[model samples]
Target: MRPKITLALNSLLVLAFFLLLWQVLTVLLHVPAYILPGPIAVAAVVGSRFSSLAASFWITTQAAAIGLAASILVGIAISLIFAQWRWLRRLLYPYTILLQTVPIVAIAPLILMWMGSGIGSVAFIAFIVCLAPIIANTTQGLISVEENLVHLFHMHNATPAQVLFKLRLPHAMPSLFVGIRISSGIAVIGAIVGELFAGSSRVGQGGLGYSITYANAQLETNYLFALVLAATVLGFLFFFLGIFLEWYFLHQWHESRRAESGN
Candidate 1:
């Protein structure tokens, strides 16, 4: 409790300090609102368009969540296959990096042409962006089973299924969550980029990415910053989800997480 409270208080203090510094700098530098809106200006914009921001945020959040779910399911399946077959990992693992190296911007257009607009394409983009981390981490974890334990199982004539179900998957949880935490950020990026090519939602509705583009086009800097802040909050929310899962699953038994109290 002490550590958690200390961390939370530190985070709040840092955030407040930066916000104060930003306000002071904006005033001292005589920065125009169009160039750089201070926190007060951004906060006012947020208040004025709170409903619209909430709607857009909800849309993006749904898309990102769906994509993240798909990535987790598929990533685990793929990792299991790779771990079960050594040759397959050697043959195909190199290409996993391609998923990261390839720019989403370049492929976003192709996906748009193929799938057109809406959540389908957006979710696909996000899935592609977030899938790599899950695969890499899960595969590493699944294969990182203790050699002594593995040999003991073998010596005991334990079947592959028993060894896998009883040993490997459990051991993989820590690394899997690490990847999830990393992928949480990537998922947000994918959703926003996906929205860029997916186009605005029907009529005036769309995700924060659309709002950002629209605000920039009209030079509504304060509103743009507000939208950006909304996205930032969404990203943090997604990341906290991974943290919660890690604590839930790891706290009880994992030494790294320290006996169910805290990680």
Candidate 2:
């Protein structure tokens, strides 16, 4: 069998084994459903509340997607500026590190106050959470060009803009993708965290974070499990999307792609 197919089958087998063990442990220990619902119970809740779960899923996805997109555009621009100016990078890069060091939960209230408790606040929080990685990775890639290549461009008398666009950006693609992959999962977590504080106040309208809070309050463990599963799936969706983009763009020329293909 092909490697991809075999890997997928192995993953399914592991999942099956885990589910079987969980079910057996719950049944043998006579565990209460409220404390630890088995996969079967969670599945039932998922089936019964599919619509609500999907709605919440969509809300979180929108927040994460918006935040991630903004981070990519803004982060790349910042990285380019940093690459062009060493003194500015020295002045500003430490602040980016400081921002990353601060916990999102600590800053989220300020975001809510500024942005007024909506998707905007949530997306901003996500953007803050994911921005540092993109800047760090892309800046490193942009500055790490080969000395020989720099000399070649210098000998050609290439303009700064030409060198930046034609050389730095191309060389930075792999690193930017790495940052993207890291940020994709982080954006989901940030969105969910943002939703906990700033999600819609309207009845029956909110994201998975709201659903999770409600489930915990109501002691609906099975429903909570279902919501958690939905969030996990959402994170996986973003991560796989990043993976696909990386493969599509880099497969032809990148060393990583060659290694993956055993070339």
- Model 2 weakest 10-residue run by lDDT: 196-205
Q: What is the TM-score of each candidate against the true structure?
A: 0.91, 0.95
lDDT of 1 at 63: 80
Decoy 2 TM-score against native: 0.95
Instruction: Report the error of model 2 at residue 90, Å.
Output: 1.1
Tens digits of lDDT, candidate 2, 212-261: 88888899999999999999999999999988999999998899867966
Candidate 2 lDDT for residue 241: 91
lDDT of each: 0.89, 0.92
Q: In candidate 1, which residue pairs get closer than 3 Å at backbone N, Cα or C atoms, i.e. clash? A: 251-260
Q: lDDT (0-100) at residue 63 of candidate 2?
A: 95
- TM-score winner among the candidates? 2
